[model samples]
Target: MAWKKDDLFLFLFIFIIVSLYPCHGNFSQANNKQPNFRNASSFSTMPNSPYDYIVVGGGTAGCPLAATLSKNFRVLLLERGGSPYGNNNISRLENFHQTLAYSTPTSPVQRFLSTDGVFNHRARVLGGNTCINAGFYSRAEPSFVRNAGWDEVLVNESYQWVEDKIVFLKPAAPWQSAVKDGLLEVGVTPFNGYTYQHINGTKFGGSIFDNNGFRHTAADLLAAGNPPNLQVFIHAPVQKIVFDTRGTKPKAIGVIFNDENGNQHEAFIKTDEKSEVILTAGAIGTPQLLLLSGVGPKEDLQKLNITVILNNEHVGKDMADNPSNNILIITPEPQNQTLLQVVGITTKGFYVETSSGFGINNDSIVTVKNGNMSELKEIFRGGTILEKIIGPLSKGNLSLVNTNVTSNPTVTFNYFAEPEDLRRCVAGVSLLLEIAKTRPVKELMGNLSYTDEMLLNMSLNANINLIPKSGNETKSLPEFCKKSVTTLWHYHGGCIVGKVVDRDYKVIGVGNLRVGDSSWFDVSPGTNPQATVMMFGRMMGVKMIRERLSAG
Candidate 1:
């Protein structure tokens, strides 16, 4: 056949029209607005092909881990919630509590109140707590890396990698400036400037939020990933890990996940010999899922009739939570909005931190009692200091329920179970009171007494007692703490490295299975922990790369 000039023109015209058709109806959305991501809404649409790595829970550690692995491997990152972008309640600092307290099924955070009555929230969305928490970012103390038996140089590199992606310098707001001065006056001296190290005394740390009020969360790490080789699915909750026990030791071959409408689908490792199933679900979620997958204390699983794959006693043990008290001091002046910046770290293992903008919308506050001081109206409309006892000697565990996605693990947070913890709390309260009485604080603040109605609004505690203020003696602060202290949402020691997983984060008893995230910490890192968690994820990414290249 001979081609003519007019025929060529006609073919070119038709090709241009189709290119501008303005529809990207296929999974390979090269021209769609959000081309690289997929909203996993139906079971039939899931990719039947296997991947080199299947990451569960697209959270703080999971996002970075998946992103880093995608550089050389085909990856599938599964998240339970929608993207962090275009969510006002998540992107803004003022809406922190609103996102936490919301009960919507699609909410990025699921709020939980423990058996001990400590209110907390777990991450349900991408970037995990970095998307919803206090936003105070600090690297783990060097002592922590040494204690965890990690190479310090490699740990430092991981910190740099994370900080380069999501962390930002937060300027001290006006209220935070006052807090810094107050900390200085109370002997928390030698400010460490705006750095991310967990140094002693008063210091300002990094934040996920930038100076322009935009959150650069762990989700941003995906930008550095190989888009063609990576597939991210949101609104797809993982149900279980399918096993192939034909081998001498059982091996994880694939996973079962549910779409948004509750239809189930399965995804498995690819033909690569190095393929793996990694779990970066947080402390509670990782252990709970393992228990559901027939791994945990054999007695507990047997009681629930769950088949036992491995009787790992350390799976859900040694759970610890940081307990804190919210000390509200009604101020004479309207306070400026402030995020977590200025921190007063004590040598006695407590943190005295301050925050403003207590005047969050009424919807964020769970209860609104107009009779007392109008909880519907903001009551803590003044300066507030959070006295957190970070070093709790008590321990707890996560118990299993029936095997259903809707069933939440029973979390037992036995806070203040040790007398030493109570004593440390008492010392923390005394230090906070001392700071409150300082000339700088007293200059603008009023009497530091809690009315009965005011005390009722703080939090739910099992035991509470308070002695009336006397002219001669300090009021019973420890008794007040037993009634009002709540979890700081810092939990650790669920699946420790030595017992549950190897130093490389590989499950010792299972082939091609690994666990990361906050659960792998042997002990409480005594910090916000998001940075530590992220750094460890980066380390895993680096290790996988090194090992693969070395094997070749």
Candidate 2:
């Protein structure tokens, strides 16, 4: 079969039309629960400045941590980005692609290209990555908790606290239903049904998107806490952590940040000995801030002319991004837009997921949001079968791009850098090809015919396909794994546990400073890390409260 120029033109026309009109199902009336967020530009001076706890980066973890701590202590949560409330792009599931397509200075997502030639985006909004990510929620594997040396009972309680406020349980949509059946057909596993617990089986996980198609982000968790004790400031990027060197060992006393207006402000800890400064600045921001504040490798700091405080060589090391590869299929009929819902957790070390009904226009050329025009790719439309390896063995390091804390650091996940990673990816792709032949998936694909040109052009659009006109699927798999590899945006590490931070999450040599986010994870938790990251915030907050009371 060959696609003529006329056929290609007709397909493009349909794609543009379908993209304009997104599927808007029944909209259920729901209450909007958010905190009273003030612009950092509003106040040049801090009101009741000295606080018991200062939580930087009011993201997926920061919001919950600050909210929980405020119940017993005065907490100030600083966010470099604006609030997610009232933003239609952030609130609606249908506008997911549009939100990512956004490329303004104040966009909810900030794009960055890894030195390894992979493009990725980091959340730049108060809700953190939850505002920009596919809203799948699942708890960490019990093994992850045990390995991290966390209290199992408290871990479950913290997970419940986060679920109660923000998580919603729902059945899969039409396309997702087909994917679920396809996975089962391919013998991915016994069906586990709806559960948030991470297990090796095909199951329906929890969603941050409710039944009404509204996305609930971590910022909403703030409403559950004591509001009087919590003060949230948006558009306030911390330049660095302020330290007092007069002590026998350097102590974190406060933080210096700039408002949206570029006005500098300093916030200090309260007189309480238990008061501390916490960093929830995600994987990248956490490490970048530490390095900028003269707390990284001595040689790197000396190169950058930064004063050396603690010569911890592991501050920005062991950065890992889950290597993701997928195949895109053009459906015969327009499908309803879906985010990640049903997932296939294979016995092997990879997870499978799917998303459908996202249409892209001719003008929608994708580029890194960091003003790099040379690296451009096309956004593919229609349904996709995506797989990402769990616990990628390969790792890389992050270094300073510049002294500016807002600028993205240079990072490379070195995807497939380890032989084990490639092996798992090849296995995952083999299973996906098998799943595509399943009855349920074939039915969803319909009588659609694609020519060699169509398949080749699809890859140009940054979508991978193992199926060829005629070739050995086995041999082509390794090449496909390398060429098609991209980020799942599930990156973690840098300020990792046991290396940079202790089991209690305190920076090894730094006093009164703690990290409580995915940055502390040695392994990316579960298939989706948001649930675990949110749970961690609540867990740490509870621990801090207990520690303070007992210490007194």
Candidate 3:
């Protein structure tokens, strides 16, 4: 996704403007508080003890995976970032943009600009992207589960497990309610009210935020686990997976990681041959670690001077991200702060979602008199209607920036690189444009008269002019898509299934090593992968527990 000048300005207004405020909000769910039995500690305080399972990365899937495994085995969960317990920016709905904007050397949100020149982020907190996302929680399509080789019954069970602890049925705010009505008004189909199911048509999905506007992250899922058996260490980053190469099949036995103070420690697995070292370090982090551990393409490892453990060519290939395009609807009326709750799922290969506030002060306004945009005092009161291309076919790759595990690897998603993907974007954007003109949505804007002709012509008073100038609407639409495309932050691939990992999520050609995160996804499950990813953690853990018990 390429960033345009206007997109940059819009992003800045949303993220950077209000970053100066300190985070402040209480967690609504009591489970969101770290439990007494959760042996969570900073890395310096952690002892180098052997564990039955060592799970690197305490983010979305990792936290739940580790928690579930602890039911019958000793588990150690290592996170590169601190806890999200008291971070108001991460927990409060109103501070959404500020949390993403408050980037620092050790901040929970790690900022990275892709090689394609589009800014992206990686979550460094215990809850992973759950700490920074818009909090929209929707399940994977049933077809997606079957295609991914997951048990359909188990998938539902796992989803219910996570929902019981964290997911909430969000009450639709006025703007979201209007947007839902607008989606129906535009033929998005029969409304599925307040559902977690990913289905066609308009519906209000689940959210991690409670009615009090406080977020409950995946970390809260740990409360369901046998806590006495789980040890969670924050600010502990694994440098590489230590392999025992003496056996016929190279086996992952331990991990070498560094503490917050830069002290190295080694954690090994117990004597049980089934013990494993799992990487739930997210899509980018998992692949990067594989490459750094000399588990990727041999030539790449040779250049990095890392000893080859396993030369897997598919480790960092086929990276994909959902290409997103959004238009800020600057309403004259004061709209309440909102995150993505109401979603419009289209049969046309994309999804539509709306959000009202991103921490932008409503009093602030931007006046543009340059080029195609008219001189209108656009207030940031109204939210944005974002279109995400479903199942983006355009793919790319991820490679090492350096040997440093913490540094972001170079990635290119090649958004709209596929002609089919471009077609989808055009279709999705056209639908979004129509939705904006619907009576229900327009009524919320309070007479912000904007017709298709005015919007396409880039009229000053049209209130939607993010597209670049072109002679015709068709030519301009594609150009707008290419330049204005941004990430929904739903990027996945890297260590995809069949190629990098097997159906069981175990790393190919290696023993006792597995990846259990979005990195295992060949296709992003639904509009949001968080729900499925959390479910995956639970399902896999349950499977492992059953396998272990059955063996005995």
Q: Give per-candidate clash totals.
A: 0, 0, 0
Candidate 1 lDDT by residue in tens digits, 1-552? 665654432232211111110000111112212325566774356555888899998888898889889999888888877788778777766555556545467788776657776555688887787777767777777788887778788889988888876677766777778778888888887787877888888888777766656566677777668887788888888888888777787788888888888877888997455899999888888888888888889999999888898889989887888777655545545566566777777787787777765433223232334213333234334556767776568878888777875567888768788888888888887677676667766666544444433433432211121213232212366666776665556787678777888988888788888997888765556356778888888888888988988998
**What are the clashing pairs of model 3?**
none
**Across residues 1-552, which tens digit of lDDT does each residue of candidate 3 receive?**
786766556455444222211111234555355743222335445564678899999888998899899999989888888878878888887777767755687898888877766667899988898888877788998889878777788888988888878888866789889888889998998998878898898988888878877888888877667867887887888999999899787889899888777888788997567999999999899999999998999998899899999988888899998887765565666677777888888999998888775555556443333223432234356666778888889999999989999898999888888999999988887887888888888887675665554444432122222334344543477766776666777889899888888888899889989999998777788888889899989999999999989998
Alpha-carbon RMSD to native, per candidate? 13.7, 6.7, 4.6
At residue 118, give the lDDT of candidate 3. 64
User: Residue 453 of model 3: what lDDT?
Assistant: 44
lDDT of 1: 0.70
A best-first ranking of the candidates according to their TM-score comes to 3, 2, 1
The count of residue-pair clashes in candidate 3 stands at 0
lDDT of 3 at 161: 85
TM-score of each candidate structure, all chains considered together = 0.85, 0.88, 0.91
TM-score of 2: 0.88
TM-score winner among the candidates? 3
